[model samples]
Target: MARDINTKKLKKNAFRYSKVRGETASRIRIPGGVINAKSMAKIAEVAETYGNGTIFVTNRQGVELPGIALEDMPAVNKAIQSIIDDSGVNQEERDKGYPASGTRNVVACPGSRLCPFGCYDTTEFARKMDKMIFPNNLHVKIAFTGCSNDCGKVRMDDFGIIGMTEPQYDPNRCVGCEQCIKYCNIRSVGALSLVNGKVVRDTDLCIGCGVCVAYCPTRAWTRSKEHYFRLVLLGRTGKKNPRLAEDFIKWADEQSIMDIVKNAYAYVEEYIDPNAYEGKEHIGYIVDRTGFDEFFKWIMKDVKLNDKAEVAHRIYWGGKHYDRSNNLK
Candidate 1:
């Protein structure tokens, strides 16, 4: 007898329906892509016991345990409670597994904690962001990269938070080695030039990637004390249209970003298509339906940007619109 399953409930509980009959995969949330060894051991234990001993890693820095029986979901949930507790994921009920899976796992790169080019602590910020927005049923994706290198591939997400550092130049320490100038041109935007034996940066052209600061051999260029970010918006990968994110704000503060993301939830609630599949839709699509001005109005509600922040008045995205025409240009 085929077991009747409520697919909706199965997905809501973070369990993926498997192609094999009576089998499902359990999705585990690992915010910031960091997990303690103990939690990992627990996950392994569950996989060996309930699943077919396969742990598949996801692009969003999460893991999926496949080949578990549908009837064993309860046991699996009870077993993974320790992992959930260890990961500090926000849950509505104890031992019930994840409350919702619409909001995908918050992805992040190993920032200043491990990487030399990292501008900020990517793991810490990713965990904080997850705490703020997880257990949500909205179809939203957010990713954080340590620096402009974008090791986390943030641009593909709905909200891409890239770390930035204002390069602080000390003229007294400069020796005119021009290493900063050399690397800036090679690895980043050519924004640095030599004038009167001193490197001068083109403020307008600079993207705050900190290539100069990293390549400066004479300690002339240093990173700013205050952490900054570049917030990119509306990047998505779908059959209709796939595109990279565009810059929404530069030199944005952390609090302002958080507030903006929170406000976006409200915006989605107001404008999201009620008939959307399972009452969920990507924010980019909603923004497409409503004007960018309206989205800006909602996301910027009561959000105070930093003095150095630069916001785009309007945004136009370029991507392959499969919906319009499938013919290759």
Candidate 2:
């Protein structure tokens, strides 16, 4: 007869079953990844009663409680549900679950809602994005930041959103000060002290980082009258390769934002194989394998390009290159 297999012993060792070893785990989702005082207190109470009296804060703004008995899972879930419901907050959403190994994670920074340098309200935009544009089965992490300061770490996500401000020049007000030229690190601005007592700039060099606009004391250099946010796609920072996101769309408003996100998701759904799990679960990987131009064409098929003036303002950073000829215009 074959040797008796120690099935019971094997099962006990193979799976960390809470019933056999007496442990449990629970995960909670915080919408927009924000948790308030009442939610914290309720979570603490649940942990005290059914768990190990401790909680773990996840990178994606989730809360986890571990080391509880198997019997406590239902009670813990119920308690958390009640707490969330009583607080008049609905935390139950299908796409909010944590990914097993891929990159369908969403991260956001405190945009204009809280930060001073924020060009637009990142939080509000993120919430909108979470609602309509998230991928159904695509495994890609997305991140959003209100400004280029990148407090939200958008550079690390597969898809990212960053804020930008464009500079405008009032030729009449420019006093031929070379301050903007001196401050620009990108050399986007060139200053010439003409015999006519005026300074000029070469607009071609402007990359629009906004260094000179912010430093201008006279406020002669101004950002575009209509300030909007820009979205960057296909960025990744990891061991295999590290890279910064490139600007794909400029001067995107709420409607345009929705269009862009939806189109991106649609493209991913069509082109990417649902079963393939090669390496990174980010759009950047797809872009690398294929090409960004192809992806852009797919998503931006019907989208109309913003005017050159609008586009110019969206990419402008402050510098002293006002055209005196158009002072009145």
Candidate 3:
């Protein structure tokens, strides 16, 4: 098969962001950022054999091989076959090469796999999402954070999946040590208090951060049966209008999250203008051009949120659209 090496389609083969003429950077997708010692050795070997001597660690928890000659990409691809296979980043097209890269890499915090305060398995979910969404050119970004700490910096991505945990309190088992209350007051949203010598939790103020569950020494605070996520959307960093994402789905389920993301690509295809911006159009800009209601209608088409899922009733975007007027100073 002819390698999809066109500058426009270079992403399909993980070659993008040109450097000097005749050279481009090849991004290696490390799904869920779980590169083991063996994988590291493999990457080092590829870099030494087919690329520049050094590899750049991407913020998205992936690797980038810079200074690769365009002509050498074929040999480079062959050299890193084992490394790519181990990462399973090519799940969509398992024939040996990447299918596409517009979805970019799926990022996740060191979740329950390593972090003490992590609520869920971020790496597992990240890889799963990657398998489903990648190998296509959708120009989308997604991130997963194990807890409210948001170590993965989810706010900058188009889709942010935050782990949520409903804390259950048992008054009888409470020793009134006030540990949960103290932790909540100082580290969390201050959703806990003491009344009548018993600890009380204000459910309305709770952000499902799981801080109380971890701080309770008496085991009075526990995780609720529901395993849910808070889905935020439309975040972007661009020259025209830069802004953080807004909350879209609260207490969302895994299936609904997937549906909304899959639908979003379809929405983009209908409204996108290939030549509108200098390059690919960020989804945020697309939403801005089309009214929110219209954009919402497309993504939510036939999508049924979970019974417990809460959808935002209204969406508003606020950002400065840079123009000559703003730069006229």
Candidate 4:
């Protein structure tokens, strides 16, 4: 799990004019991966005025401006700092890492904040994640998405938050159309004709993909207000290496979400070897080598578990299945 100096090289080469090989390379963190036209313009100005006229975007949604001279690093930092200050973020707050630190590392899609199909406000929750649990000892990337659509590509991160909603059955509105059953790819739904010439739905099989709800003409499959989010950890996606994160927790609220993140960081800090590999930075590699169950127990030493149902759930991805029962129980 050597750190991909080559990946960094590719990134650097992509913005060749940025001169990343020098001693004073600059890295800029963008909170929630959010950027405004004005902020971008300021970045361009900084590139032109302070350093080379180029920028590189990181997978974590950070921007790096290379080729900055050692002497000019202070100026570049100041210029970027000023723009961040005028961007409605307080200077003092920035110093205190309000929009930096863990917040800066967060990448979130425009969930319910603006997207019509979004089931939740992923941006808002991402901001909360930055503030509450980001400053810990964890060194892996975390990503969030507003819905199962995963526009933010949460599956690629060490920790991922996916928005989800459970469908509610309206017995009165159900026309037994079986449209939902037809559209469901997961076969989580089933329909049967009733004596009254209407269809009845079996809710147990519904996987909550929303396919039925979208196609249903009768609007029988409506989303409930009881919507929460999904949490996954130790997942990675790429061509050379592909893996799916196991579900650490599901349908979690803000408080539970914080607890999960804290637990994850605690685990990483306790057992992971920092010098294991130069570029072996993510959590999945650690799990691959040390075993996830042992990792989980090391972190949950003081915590008590009441339920282990989710532990037995198998995670299927990358054409392989991983049973987490040993880790959970």
Candidate 5:
């Protein structure tokens, strides 16, 4: 029997109202895109028991169990408690499901745990960030990629955190083979040149991608011990404008990046449109409305950046605006 449902409440509770009447999908949050095998089995159990025995993987590293009866939401919630607990997702109560579904699951690529080119532990950082800001209703997207290779496609999100590492060059170890130079030109920005039987890295031109370090034959170039990041901001996809995030800070420390993102929530609360659809609005749209200068002031409040961090005074983004004209120029 179909019953009157509060669709708004349903969505906030992390259940997706389906096209089919009296059916909903349970959205499960998977921070860092890494879940244990036991949790995965539990999700499968939930699907088989409550859903149509099918699981839909979401792009944001979440899972959705579709074809669940609307009335079975409570049972579904209780069944998924173990998965929620295992994932370390913050909750207001046990067996009540996700408290809020605004902030999307933190997405990450396999970093130092698996990939050779990875500069840092992307999954660890993603999980930490998720812990700081979850169980809230904020239309924000954040992603972490292992390195500039950007396997995570982070540039499409609101906060794209790309890994970086400053290369430490040792002239003593360099054999003048120029392998670093060759590969840097091919795989990354050509910031290295041979000088006096050794390689000279153009510090001004280097984006800290550490390509030279990876190709160094005799450990002539090595990554810095201090892990750094390239923080790109405000990229989004929508009907009006779909754009990639621009560089906000380079060579940024992890703590400063986390603090900056945390501050952004306050900025959004102060400036988000009251009439935004379902009280949800992308941070990029809010930035567009308030202007970058204002957004910067708000986002940078009390956030202390390290000395090596380079911040962009201003950012500009260009993308296809579907809301505009159809006439090709």
Candidate 6:
């Protein structure tokens, strides 16, 4: 008789159960969606050898080899071993499948390496975040967008990390061209305006998108060394309320970003429902059960933010409970 599939182990390797009994689909991790040609060949080989000779690219930018029989899992897993190493799927520990399954694939937009508008190295930073938080059972989605274009759809993810740049202006070099103002009005947070024939940036309205900084001529605008990040949180799709992720962190440094994300895992562990199905609960749902005030308390617990970093001044969700009371949940 074929051995029973170890649901726990398979999930750790990014496998999902199929409709057909005694079969599964293995999700191959490609952090930041960056994959080498050689690795792609190996994945195809695994599919042909142990699966249905096919692989599906997940919306999260990973690969899923379908039609794996429970009996063939061992062979499939062995094939995946080298890939896990080369891809750094779960390098948090050695000789282990994965610690948890909550943190999903780290999706990213094309970075400065490929796009001129890109601000940071999306794939590199995404890899760093992948190793930092993975294999956890809590349901979470983390994504990285290179710039304000948000080609990666950061706003729709559980944790959206958007690259930011603080533009420093040299008034002496100002040509009174009103170019920044024109650029800022569209495709931006509407923070720039002409003041006395020079561009004045409204700090409150600015989202740190670097639009003016990019379009500014004569080198009047320069990027800050701080390398800030804007973090949006909690947006999800589920049986109940589906809403866009809300912005929480603005102008955060790498350290602050890492710390807040690390702390968020702790928050999930603390408030996570015990009776959740499949040994998991969406963090968004947990936030619903508990109040946002309570949820953020845990998120912000014991974390020191940078002076530049701004926490959500007042987080307000207009949507009501499923009951339709229309109050913040």
lDDT of 6 at 57: 83
User: Please, what is the TM-score per model?
Assistant: 0.98, 0.66, 0.92, 0.71, 0.98, 0.90
Candidate 4 lDDT over 153-195, as tens digits, reads: 8877777887766676677888777666665644433432354
Q: How far off is residue 79 in model 6, in Å?
A: 1.2
lDDT by residue for model 2 (36-131), tens: 788789888877888789987877665667676655554665677654453233234322222122334356677657765566666666656665
Q: Give the range of the ten consecutive residues with the poorest summed lDDT in model 6.
A: 317-326
- The residue pairs found clashing in candidate 5 are none
**Better TM-score candidate (1, 4):** 1
Q: In model 6, which residue pairs have backbone atoms overlapping below 3 Å?
A: 100-135, 100-136, 101-135, 101-136, 102-136
Candidate 3 global CA lDDT score: 0.81
Instruction: Using lDDT as the measure, name the better of candidate 4 and candidate 6.
Output: 6
lDDT of 1 by residue, 197-265 (tens): 999999988888888988888889999999999999989999889999999999999999999999998
Per-residue lDDT of candidate 5, residues 7-46 (tens digit): 9999998999799988999999999999999999999999
Model 3 regions more than 4 Å off: 1-5, 91-96, 277-279, 319-321, 324-329
lDDT of 6: 0.79
Model 3 TM: 0.92
RMSD of each: 1.1, 11.9, 2.9, 7.9, 1.1, 3.2
**lDDT of candidate 2 vs native?**
0.58
The candidate with the higher TM-score, 2 or 5, is 5
Model 2 earns a TM-score of 0.66
Candidate 2, poorest ten consecutive residues by summed lDDT: 312-321
**After superposition, candidate 2 runs with Cα above 4 Å error:** 1-25, 31-33, 68-73, 82-105, 171-225, 237-243, 277-280, 288-293, 308-329
